[model samples]
Target: MGVCFSTEIKDKSSFHTGVDTDGNDHSTNSSKVSSVPPTPRSEGEILQSLNLKSFSFSDLKTSTRNFRPDSVLGEGGFGSVFKGWIDEQSFAATKPGTGMVIAVKKLNQESFQGHREWLAEVNYLGQFSHPNLVQLIGYCLEDEQRLLVYEFMPRGSLENHLFRRGSYFQPLSWSLRLKAALGAAKGLAFLHSAKTKVIYRDFKTSNVLLDSNYNAKLSDFGLAKDGPIGDKSHVSTRVMGTYGYTAPEYLATGHLTSKSDVYSFGVVLLEMISGQRAIDKNRQFGKHSLVEWAKPYMAHKRKVLRVIDSRLEGQYTLEAAHAVANISYRCLSIEPRFRPSMAEVVKELEKLQEPKETRPRRHSSHGTRTRRLSSGGLAAADDAGLGAYPRPQASLPSK
Candidate 1:
């Protein structure tokens, strides 16, 4: 839910980059400053009331047959997402999937997300347009009901395919998995490299929605923040993040920065490659966690292959697997400085998939299968024309 980092949106110290996010200049760790937040049009109010161009409740209700439970697509941290339709005015072009099918996310009034979070979602997703980011059509907020309209993702979330109970879903092949990783990486890089950096506070399998082709669309920007500019290296704030994915520095000290997002991304990447949950409360004692179990292997670089998902056995090239494992190790490194930037990660994955003409490598050629074990416990293995991942074998639950 938190992508391992948990937080409640606090009243920021009067910062605004536009209608989307606000920056705090006068606020500090010791100084508590509060002023009225910038009054901006909430996406819901604007779409439903301000614009005749948007779909009305009656229009959506008629199409959805009065919000029938049968039309409900799925439920998540926000609320239920239902499949509904809109006329040509909503989406021109042509009709393929039932005339502009939209996803209606009904917010839980009793839940932790309130008006501010709802407004933030509308402001950001409403204007933020990208093929990889989920499209926000409009919203509706009346009385106890708060709803966000988004583009329907037919294939559902990556989590459903990865780790739903009793779900005998089709396994993601090596190439397809790599492709998904690449696409998701591209989305992260875009956000990090935007004119103004946007920190994705929550990044996990559930947040990565997949369309019919399994393309990733990052959703839920309730916790998205404007990163520090100029000489500012960190954003000072109380520690508010999920447990497993939170950076040690952020958790130990309230120094928020880009590295915090990188740490979460690393955990997500590890889960993608290995098909493991970041934290498994049901796991016995110490074994109930992906991070705790994989840390030893990442540090030493021996037996890291043992952590690879058994379901993918032999489906992935040894060299490719080793390179990805090595990258994952760097991503999960406890120190933020040790982790590679998102751009570096994208490059490594692209290289691991192809040859040096596109991306260079740590090894001269792939498939060498020669492992060099250093005294420090780093093992480098080559199976493709890429790099080596030398990690110690850390024991985990059996297949």
Candidate 2:
């Protein structure tokens, strides 16, 4: 389910009252108009000031072919995504397969998300422009209708690659997985380090959209919020995010920080490594909880291999596998402060792409013998160092 917020305009005529959101009447008084107009603050004013293209219900209907069932790309709690076509330059309605493809998300009027969440999505996506982030083209807000239009992503979402079953789905290779991880990490890092600092409260495989070449972009910014600034430790917000992906601290205390997003990324990383959903009830009794069940194996040098996905068929090297699990382990630290920053995580992921011959190895500080790396980057199980794994200074306090 989506978060609920009230911000809809009840009367369309109230928007064109010639009064800015600040209650300053700009309309002419006795045939005399003001020389300068006030800045826009309301949804209508903000949309006009942004110069964002506004589509009428009729225009979108023509573009989406009246929301045909076959055009549906996917559906979620928010609403259904439909495939549509638009003129390349003008963004006008075009015949199917004749122009640039677009994805139209028609909000479910009965869904938990209302105008507030919808406006948040537009406000964020309309302003931010990054290669790792999905592009928002325009929006339609005719009467009660709320629709978002975006550039078409051909390959769909990372969730389909990681969890979807059947002949139509293919398991992501180690190289592709690493690529997706790196791309997603870059996107999150961008958000956290932006001038205004955005916290992607929702980070999961499904929000990671894939292009034709397997490039990943972050989508769905409805749950995103401005992060804390100077002198502020965290932002207090109502607990909202997907189950299993939310950070423990954020879930418990409603105090959100960038580290909260790091924890969510860790969950996604774990999913990538183990080929399991964050929460699955279909697994064996004790193993249903991916994070809880994988923690022990992740900490055990000899048993770490057991947590890896069987579908991979030993495609990855021993050292690389341990390194990934180590990263995941650090990210999943119970203490939020113990988790590495997104920038640090990105650097570590990037290092994994180095040639095996040039990869560095460290000896255990406890004097445990180090294993020599094979040509395939495999190391002896006994040589693994669980002691080298970083841990929090003390046990975390409960909510």
Per-model TM-score, in order, reads 0.72, 0.77
Which has the greatest lDDT?
Answer: 2
What's the lDDT for residue 208 in model 2? 82
lDDT of 2 by residue, 126-236 (tens): 887899998888899887899988888766667656674544323676667878898999999999894748888878877787776677899877667788777999987
Q: How accurate is candidate 2 locally (lDDT)?
A: 0.68
Error of 2 at 112 (Å): 3.4
lDDT of 1 by residue, 218-319 (tens): 877665666677899876654444446667776666566777877888787788777777877777787677877876765443466667776565455556
| CA RMSD per model (angstroms) | 11.7, 13.4
Q: Largest TM-score belongs to which candidate?
A: 2
How many clashing residue pairs, candidate 2? 0
- The regions of model 2 sitting more than 4 angstroms off are 1-51, 167-169, 354-399
How many clashes show up in model 1?
23
